[model samples]
Target: MISVVLLGSGNVGTHFFKAIEKAENVRVAQWFSRQIDSIKGYKNKTAITDNLSELMEADLYILAVSDDAIATLSSALPFENRLVVHTSGSVNVHDLDKKNKRGVLYPLQTFSKGAEMDFKNVPICIETLDKKSYPILKEVATSLGSPTKRVNSNQRRVLHLSAVFVNNFTNQLYRIGHEITESEAAEFDLLKPLIMETAKKIQTLSPYMAQTGPAKRHDKKTIEKHLDLLKNPEHKAIYKLLTKSIQNTHGR
Candidate 1:
């Protein structure tokens, strides 16, 4: 069995621990957090520590901390030359201190505290500075039942940027829609089906082919009506920008 030392107790780290708990071939040997209380609940399951020197021997050391902390934390590890990886999409594999074998096991999905995540559905993007580390990281990812893809640092950065557009930006648009509906005393829930249908369409149809509505149709009257209805200048600006973007995409 592959033993893992999980360092960090945030959303990604917490989820990784839970997923590994269910995996048959891998187990978390220890969990580390700056503040022990963050992972106090898991003390019954695995060794938990706040001191780096107390870290036990393990097959893998996963630094699932924030992107900014990866380098500093890796450098501070008491042991070295072991397989060390960080769960960051944008951070380069080489960012880890050269004291150990460095790699990345980025799970390409949004994570939130208290939300349920199915590990089988999350895509794991793997990158390693040393060639031999690839199979080890791949095996760990496979144990989690996640699909693995080999991605270079540059590719991972692009993937992360695209994710921000699709997930973060799209969620902000949903917030704006909620605000608009509330202003008109309309039920925002009424748009739920449309949202789901739009997502479903992109599964079988290319986003370009699935395009619909006023902007895609070049319905200037409807577009103007929307812009006029948006009383908030910020909302109107976003509407205009997105409308222009859609129009340009469709050659309207």
Candidate 2:
């Protein structure tokens, strides 16, 4: 079995650790975290450690820490010239330096604790400075049910930024929708069908063609009504700007 150490227990780390538990030929040899109480459940089979020395024996160390702590934590690890990988999207693999056989194992999707994800469907973005380590990482990724893709550092950065807009921004829009409906005591569940349909359409329709609403048709009366309904200044500004943008794009 290929022994591995995971160095964080946050959202991504927790999801990844659980997913890896189901794969063969791999085992979580050790786990390290500052807050040991949070991960007490994993202390049974996996050696849990707050000290860096316990990480010495593992074949590979996966730093699931934040991008800001990568350099500091890497420098503190007891061993040198061992294989090390990080799971980060915005941070480049090169940031880990040449001290270890550095690589990246970025999952392109958002991870939330307690929410199950299909490892098979999530694309695994893999990168490595050492060519020999690439296949090993690929095999590990495949065994865990992910579709692997080789992405360079620059491409990974762009992909991550795009993910924020598509996932984060869209979720914020949903939250706004919920808030608006709740204020007037309307059921937010009413929007579920529309939400699912909008997402389904994107699979076949170009977003531009699938786009609808008063903004696309230049229904000035509806736009004015929406503006009047919006109580938050920021939300109103956003709605007005987006409407104007959509109108301009469609030549309305």
Candidate 3:
């Protein structure tokens, strides 16, 4: 059995704990949070501590902390030569203090508190400074039923940047759509199907092939109408920028 000490209590950490708790081959030997109350609810399931010195022996130390904290936390670990991995896409594996064996097990997915996540579909990007640590990280990812991909720090950074475009930027566009619908007293729910269909199309069709609507068609009249309808300058600016981007992409 693979035993792990999970150090962090935020969204990624919480979800990791829940998934690990259910995995038969792996178990969380301990959970650490700066403030004990953040993980107090799990006290009944595993050892919880706020002190680094109190951390127990485990097969892996998974630091699911914020990107900024990974280095500091790993440096502060009271032991060395142990397998230590962080769940960060952009942070380099070498960022962890050399006191311990360092690696990364970045789950390439958006995480939010109180949201359900199915690890089986989450692609875990794994990287390790030491060759031997690769299989160990893969085993932990497998324990969560997640598919693993070997990614260098640079590839992971590119994936993370692309994710920001597809997930974060797309969500902001949806918010703008919601605002636009509200301005006309229209139901935003009306656009839900379109959103789902757009997502579904990209599954079987390349995004370039799936492109549609005024910008892709170069319907200048419709584009101008959209700009005129957008009362907010920020929204208009975004619309114009995206329209230009789409037009440029299609050789307009």
The true-versus-predicted C-alpha distance at residue 154 of model 3, in Å, is 1.0
User: Positional deviation of 85 in candidate 2, in angstroms?
Assistant: 1.3
Q: Write the per-residue lDDT of candidate 3 for residues 163-236, one digit (tens) a residue.
A: 99999999999998998899879999989999999999999999999998899999999999988888999999
My TM-score estimates for the predictions, one after another, are 0.98, 0.94, 0.98
Task: Tell me the tens digit of each residue's lDDT in model 2 across 1-252.
Answer: 777898998998888788889989678888899888878998886789888876647667889999998888887887778888999999878778567789999998888898998898789999988898888788878878999999999999999999998899999989988999988999999999999999999999988899899999889899999999999898898898889888888998
Model 2: how far is 160 from its true place, Å? 0.7
Give me the displacement of residue 59 in model 3, in angstroms.
0.8
- Clashing residue pairs, backbone N/CA/C < 3 A, model 1: none
Estimate candidate 3's alpha-carbon lDDT, on a 0 to 1 scale: 0.93
| Reference-based lDDT, each prediction | 0.94, 0.87, 0.93
Better of 1 and 2 by lDDT: 1
Q: Give me the displacement of residue 64 in model 3, in angstroms.
A: 0.8
**Best-fitting candidate, scored by lDDT:** 1
TM-score of candidate 2 versus the correct structure, residues matched by position: 0.94
85-192 per-residue lDDT for model 1 (tens digits): 999988888889998998999999999979989998899999999999999899999999999999999999999999999999999999999999999799999999
Q: Candidate 1 or 2, higher TM-score?
A: 1
